[model samples]
Target: MDFKYVTQEERERLYNEVWDEPLKIVAQRYNMSDNGLRKHCKRLWIPLPSVGYWAKIKAGKKVFKPDLPKVRGELKRYVHSYAIKYRSDIDKYSDVELQSMKGLSLLTDGTIRYVNEICSNIEVKNQLRNPHNLIKQHKDELMYRKRRDKELQQASFNTDYYNITKSKYRENKPMIPIYVSEVNLNRAYRIINALLFAIEEMEGFANVMLDSGNDKGYFVIMKTTFYFIMMEEGKNKSKNNAEEHVPILVLSLSAGDEYYKCTNYSFKFKDKVDEPLEKQIGIIILEMLQTANKILIEEMLRDREYEREIKKKERQRRLEQMRKGELEEIKILQQAASDWNKAEEIRKFTNQMELKIGEIEDEEKRHKLSRWVLWAKDKADWIDPLIEKEDKLLGESEYIFEEIIETQ
Candidate 1:
């Protein structure tokens, strides 16, 4: 299904095919559309059956078949594949026939060199030498758990075990997960040690933390942490329905990291059929570093964008603050203008009162009225913001937001 390799499907073969069965059936076999196949037959000089040819043949009537015509140039033969073929002579083919020719290519030299550079000097040895301290710790923990399991099993057989509480068989906690069959554990440890070494070479740390389910491997670099998982093909049901572990160890390595918001990029390396897991360590390292390089580049781009967004938002925040202060200042100016107008009105009223008080015949009453008018003028001055005359009860500080209450 991948490439439908229908090779040498030329004029004579195509002619026989269209005549033998429906174009749709032939198209399905060749992984092509019926209409596209019909056009293909036309260009290949292969004559097709008329619309009612099948019906006539079903009725036991004789049908006419045309002879295949000869094509001059590159239309003589056809093939279906990833690439197209043309004859050695290019000048014989016209523009229309030449259009069918296509070229295919492989990985560029630069990409090959990049992957090779990352994978350089990386390999899994026959045996691990002085395994990393963390690996030793995890190995010891596993041994302790195995012994505890055996103890728990023996205790289960004893009648007195029921008298004891469940806390007696508490399992030792695991560290730095290394999941594999006992047969493949040593190999897995060697591979992991190489992995840890690679991380150290990268000037990054190898860390383990429970992430999402049983996955515990993590690689920290450039202030970013990504999940990593190296697992052997376990006892799994095969296509034949037999459940058994693969005799040859096949390690599958996968890794992923968050990009923007909820987006994640996951990279996986498949096991090579002809080679063992130990032989492919360099290629695995290549894949890992290549994926990391791409992710780090993306992180750099996103960081720049993030910085731009922060600056944009900060500018917006400052503008909002400035607008708020401007509104408060405008309100203060408007309120001051209103109070000044009211103060001028009050002063004019007191002046008129003073003139009226002069007309009184009683000197004592006149003096008392004049004193009242002077007090009224002083009240107006206290109310005016520009004058800011302080009242004995209010002190020097402005209390514009509070109302004065007269105490009895």
Candidate 2:
């Protein structure tokens, strides 16, 4: 019935008995105030199931949260892909044509999917058609030449030697009338094709110039570079009848002025190059200049991309290292926390033992000396000072008890 003097075991049994009751009922049964009951529950490390716990049980699943919506419409999707596919044709088309194509449904996602499907079909078709046959057909002439060369090698030694030496000399010869190798001729053809393509692409007024021999003859050389030559003839008059003369010949050269050095190739109108030809020349020169410029730009862009990739990798590595350091720091802090908790527990237990010692009555203390003896038996190093003080006090009390006994 005395709450203040209740033993630990009795308090534990009382707590277990009333734990399932309402707070008021439990407090009344224990003859304690509500606040005191609450304090006791807290000290015993008990948790009450609140509304939040009931809500979780009712829900039966985790709650869902949605992320914020993203902003759209910065760029036109798939425009780059379309541009790359039709770059050559697009470059030749007028602005009006480009606009017309831009308005088409190709920009839609459905159209893109259809286009991809078509491309895949085309690839499969080409694969099935054995497209390598077309390549072999194109190289047939080169193969024939190689076969002929091999046959010539198998012929008489003197004939073969003479042919090989003659071929070598022909290869080295400048402006030789002999038939040139097909490979060199092919290269020249490709160059001429490129020049013609440029001229046509520029609408015929290529900014190129040509030299003329006389008013009657215009000649252009296409040896090392392209040139255009023009010539006009003087009027021939009979019986006082005059007529304006037309240019006798208009010639273009894929080769330039570097080839012609003969005085016989004298020109009359070296400065009379067409304005269109001048423009073409300007374009060619501009394109040549831009070649180096393009290369420099591409190299710089590539270097920047590579540097960005390296920086990204380095950042990732640094982040991983930082995470590892943070984990290590957390582990160290957790260990320190555990060690502090254990030291606190030990201090609490020591204080409890000290309180128990203080609570003993004098006669009870003498009778319970055996209990203290047992508690301090193997822990002499820890309780030696306290035990010595207790023994001194007890000895004086015993002498007083003996004096009272004698007086009685």
Candidate 3:
């Protein structure tokens, strides 16, 4: 195993992630022993979280981050070696290793560039004034919920939200709702449309479609179906009359058909509505591509490691079978004790073939060698089979009594 190199940005991300959780939890993610990882951190001058940092946060108290130290010389990015743990059933999977993150990053970069080009050339419609009507409906539902805090009303709101806003890519192809004021929705729409176009230009991603209903849509990446969605929460009103609607745009990468979560993310933002449409959408696309890249990389790494383990197990199985064959040969030779030379020749040939089979790396070659080994085994088994004659010879024993009388 080789150490993975991390860039400055990745280092920062890892540092933040470690601080957000316990050391043991973070160590497990990188396949590192906890104490070993702690020592690595010390050697690298990477600061660990304070003893009670997580405790304070859990208790709803304010906590601050420790400043990263300045690098004195050439920076090191070497990570601890990652090992794939053995599992009895690992050989069942078709793919052994997942795609490499390096390759994925290249794809992501291409997608981002494509999206950038699309965004640059395309006209982003002013959709705020004619904003999706579902925005108003969501607001109405919110108002209804505020007046009557019942579960039924909440469920209705949730249903409306999903139906009108989220299921644009389903088989039924439902009607899309006009949600959010045109001002709030246009930026999201423009960015999403650009993303679709960029996905079209990129390889390994296809079946890209935007839904007619709402802002929910779906696409395929690396053979997996993923939903890209934009949802708006109703406006919030403060006593001072400050009003704003929070619109969330996300790509859900999950396992279930009905329930998916936006777990793999590159960037998260706050108060993005105030940003320029191009900047906002560009940033979103960048992060989205990054997230997709990471997912592909993880899948590839898993597949690679899995395949490696499967090969290892196969090698072990072959060796065990060979050992069993050798033991059986030994038993047969001991029984036909008088025909040692003939049996030895057969055993020697079998051993030679077995060694040749082990040395062959090409699978087809190994298979051929294995067939030859089987042939040798069959020849060895036919060495001596006159069990009745051998028994008669033992029973005859005529000279034994005469030798005893002469000795007397």
> In candidate 1, how many clashes are counted?
0
The digit string of per-residue lDDT tens for model 1 on 217-261 reads: 676643345565555554334445566434444444444453364
lDDT of 1 at 377: 86
Model 1, runs deviating above 4 Å: 1-118, 159-170, 173-176, 207-215, 221-229, 234-246, 252-262, 294-317, 388-408
For residues 367-396, what per-residue lDDT tens digits would candidate 2 score against the true structure? 575466545442432223222223433331
**lDDT for position 405 in model 3:** 48
**Best-fitting candidate, scored by lDDT:** 1
TM-score (all chains, Cα) for each model? 0.54, 0.25, 0.38
Ranking of all predicted structures according to lDDT, beginning with the best and ending with the worst: 1, 3, 2
Candidate 2's displacement at residue 67, Å, is 74
Candidate 2 off by > 4 Å: 1-289, 355-408
What lDDT does each candidate get? Answer: 0.62, 0.37, 0.50
